[model samples]
Target: MKRVIQFATGNVGKHALPLIIERPGLELVGLHAHGPDKVGRDAADICGRSEPTGVIATKDIDALVALGADCVVYTSQAEMRPQQAIEEICRFLRAGTNVVGTSMVWLVAPQHADAWIREPLAAACAEGGTSLYINGVDPGYSGDSLVYTALTLAGRATGITVSEICDYGSYDDAEFTGVSFGFGTTPDHTPIMFAPGVLSSLWGGQVRSLADVLGVTLDEVRESHESWVTPEPIDCTMMSVAPGHVAAVRFAVEGIRDGQPVITMEHVNRLTPITAPDWPYPPDGRLGVHRVVVHGNPGVEINTRLGLDGVDHNDGGVISTAARAVNAIDAVCAAPSGLLSVKDLPAAHADRVMW
Candidate 1:
């Protein structure tokens, strides 16, 4: 069994720990956390498991790097701190540890990663003969990989659009929903997601990746967005949304080729069902939906939803994101030494371990 470590115990990490423990061909070695509060705690405890695994969490980066594990599942949030996440992952890779996780969305297509970030990671991988792969629910499988897979069935593909349409009312993270996404913020307040080039920077890679797969060269990438305010005050799991505050948002990063949108990545995020009545709704009317449409000869549309075992769609999304990363560990370790993408890795399957 290959030894592996988890880099953080946050939302995604919490969901991943148990899967890593139960999966076949993997042995849990260590758990790494950022704050002193989490240091020295049992891995099982950090993941909310009653049983103990004997592995303790630590904040000592140098010591953790020296463990010489086969891989590190780096799931620390990168949306807010891209540079720090890149640096940390590079450190692990340079230590000859294969790295896989959902931290860097742009690295879902490694070639699309910024030069400054990609160059050092490539150098580190070359020096240590390790590999790194970045993936997640949206940017990884549901958005990029799944879209490409569906396109294969189409005889003549004219346009492709992938969307993450979900309600954020159940999301418990106020900072993320209210502040980051501007869910409960004023209409005039510009969230980072709507800032110039931010949407393109975060999701343009997915659009470009699809174009690359279809052998279509994009002339340029463009961005468009729209938002709505809550008509009445609504109390959500995370924060309260006052009337006239931002409640729903829709944005797209379009890959333009031949003066037309050939590839697009769009998000229709709402805090309430009534917020955006005119916007596109999920086919099944589920709380959360991921859809990919190929407007072509066959006119294919694929939809996916998750709300299993009383878990809300927002949290279900977190679990799916973590699972995608955890399942890819083995493939990443076996890949060629360098930054890898979903296209470079083999199919990831759940290796059920019979206890």
Candidate 2:
């Protein structure tokens, strides 16, 4: 069994902690709780399990590293604390601990990373003989891997578009909804997500990865976005939106090669489906869906939806994001020591994973 340690108890962590306990081939060794309330609590308790898993949560990073697990599922909040997260990931790698990450997704293709991330991650892996792989749902499988698989039938591609159509009313993130997304703010209020080079930093790596899969080198990667006004007050699951404020938005990051955009990643996000009447909606007129359009011979277009039995689309996304990393634990632990890309690993699925 692969020994596992989970850092932090957030949305993904809450799902991962208990999941690691139940998966047959994985052993839960420790939980690195981030908040004081979670520290000193039983791992199972932190994730709402009635019985104990014999693992306690601690805020002490060094102590957890000393336990020396086979892998660390690093899912801490990354958008705000990128440097700290990278440092923590390196520390774990240098201690001979492999890492499967849902945080700082740009690492999905370390080649797209700047020297600050790529250099240190490489050094740490070499120093301690470990590996690190980062992935998730939208930026993970749905971004590049799924596209690569779908392109199997293509002869030559003209253009490709991956669209994420999701309603954010049920996504419980106030910081993202209110400020980062400008959900309850005026048009002039630039959401950090829309700031210069922000969206590119987040998904450009995936764009480049897809380009590489298609055997093309990009001329440049560029971004474009537009936000709509609410025109009236509305309340979403996360926060309240005021009239005349930014309500919905559509954005794309394009990877250009040979003076044209060969690959594009787009997102259509609104507080609710009806909020942005002109923007694209899911194929089924639902809240959340991932759609891919491959513009080539024997063209392919498909929509994939993932949701929990009783949970909303947002919660299901969190669970899926966690699953992508957790299920890859054994593969990452078993790979050669280094910063691994999706290109370097085997098909990342667990046996009987659907069960």
Candidate 3:
């Protein structure tokens, strides 16, 4: 069994806690809670597990690393604190611990990572002989590898687009919704998330990854976004929105090749499905919808929906991200040292589950 340490028991990390506990081949060695409120609590209580996992949450990173885990499932919001996250990851690798997570979307393509990051990350791996992987659902698997999966079935593909339409009405992170998304802010001051090059920074890796997988060199990645204000004061799951405040936003990051838009990654986020009536909605008129469209000789479209009768995915996006990280532990632990992406490892099959 591979000994594992779960880092950051936040929105995403909390979902991973139970999955790690459920996996028979993985042993939960340590838990790193993000805040003091969570520290010192039983892992089971933090994740709502009935039975005790016997692991207590700790805020001490050094102490957790000293556990000597085979792999660390990192789920911290690296985009918010990139430098700190990178330093911590290096410490883990240099201590001979592998890592897998969706923290830094840019690192999905290590070759495309910035020089400052690539150099030190390489050094850390060399020192401890460990590997690092960045994986997730949207920026991780859906927009890149999943897109590639559809592209392989196409005959003479011309262009590809991946669109994720999800209602954020129930997302519990107020800071992520109201503050970062500008849900209650005026359009005169657009959200920082839609600022110059921010969209590309968050998702350009997926576009670039697809370009590389297709053997096509991209000229650049372009960004465009639109935000709609609420007609009246409305209350959603995360927070309340005032009249004329931002409620819905549609954005895209397009990959340019040979002076043409070759690959596009788009997101349609809204406080509610009805907020953006003019914009794209769920294909089946549900809560969660992800579409992978390939423009080619015959054309291909793949739609994945959540919040159904039997399976409730309206609030499962974070869990999906966590699941991807947890499932990759073995592949990441066995791989060679240094920065690694999905291309570097073998197919990470789900243990005892269907392919």
Candidate 4:
């Protein structure tokens, strides 16, 4: 059985714990939390499981690393603290623990990483003979893996585009919805997402990954974005937005080859559905959807809807983000010592037998 430890008890990590506990081939050995409040708590209790797992959450990273687990699911937030996240990941890898999770979405394919980021991770993997794989909803399966899988049916591909159109009003993270995305902020205030090179830093790797799969070399990666403000005040699950405040955002990362975009990943995220009427909407009219369009011979357009048993769109995204990491544990643990990506690992499927 594969022994796994989870880092952090955030939304993704909390949703992923029970999955590890319930999976037949995995054992939950350690739970690591950063804050004092969560430390010393039962793993199951932290995740709200009815029964307790003997493992307790600890703030001791060294102790957790010494547990000799097969893998560490590093689900801590990476966007704001990228350098720190990379340092922590390198530390875990050098301590001989394989890692697979959502931190450092660009690390999904390490080859695309800059020299400063790539060298240390490479050295760590070499030192301890461990591996690291990172993924999530947008840069994860929904954008890269799923789009590549759908391309198999195409005869000749001219252009490819994948879009994640969703409403973020129900998302519970105030810092994320308010400060990061500028959801409740004024129209002129730029959020981190709109910061120069931030989008490219987070998503350019996925664009390049697709290009590699298609055997095309991109001349450059370009970004475009537009934002809309609420005409009237609106309250969301996370925070309240005043009139003439940032409400919706539409952005795209395009891979250009020979001065034309050959591949593009776009996102139309909003706090309310009525804000961006001109932008694309989910076909089924669900709160969330991931759509892929292949512009070529026998062009194909596919739409993926998420919302089950009355779950909200943002909650559904969190579950999927967690599952993407949880399902890849076995594959990552079995891989050779190095940074692994979707291209390096096989298509991971859910353990339906355990269901």
Candidate 4 residue lDDT tens string, 19-106: 8888888899999898888898899888888899999999888898889888999998876887888888888899899998887777
Error of 1 at 220 (Å): 1.0
Estimate every model's Cα lDDT from 0 to 1. Answer: 0.85, 0.84, 0.83, 0.85
Instruction: Give per-residue CA lDDT, model 1, range 1-355, as digits (tens).
Output: 8899999988889888888887878889989998788888999888878989999999888888999999999888887887888888888888999999898787888898789878988998998899998888887787766786787889999999888999888887777546877888898999988999988888888778778778999999999998899889988786788898988899999999889998888899888687788998877668889888999898999888877778888888989888888888878888899988887876544455344
Error at 219, model 2, angstroms: 2.0
Best by lDDT: 1
**All-Cα superposition RMSD per candidate:** 1.5, 1.5, 1.7, 1.5
lDDT of 1 at 82: 78
Once model 2 is optimally superposed onto the true structure by TM-score, how far is the C-alpha of residue 172 displaced, in angstroms? 0.6
Runs in model 3 deviating more than 4 A are 307-312, 353-355
Tens-digit lDDT track of model 2 for 258-354: 7888899999889877688977888765689988889989799878787847678888888888888888887888889998877787865565475
Worst-scoring 10-residue span by lDDT in model 4:
346-355
TM-score for each prediction?
Answer: 0.96, 0.96, 0.95, 0.96
Instruction: Give the Å error, residue 290, model 2.
Output: 1.1
The digit string of per-residue lDDT tens for model 3 on 1-355 reads 9999999888889888888888888999999986878989999999998999889999899998899999999998878788888899999999999989878777887887778777887888899899988988777777866776787789989999899888888888888645767777888887778779888887887788778888988888999998998988878777888888888888899999888898999988888766878988876557778789999878989887644556556467787788888888888787878788888877654563332
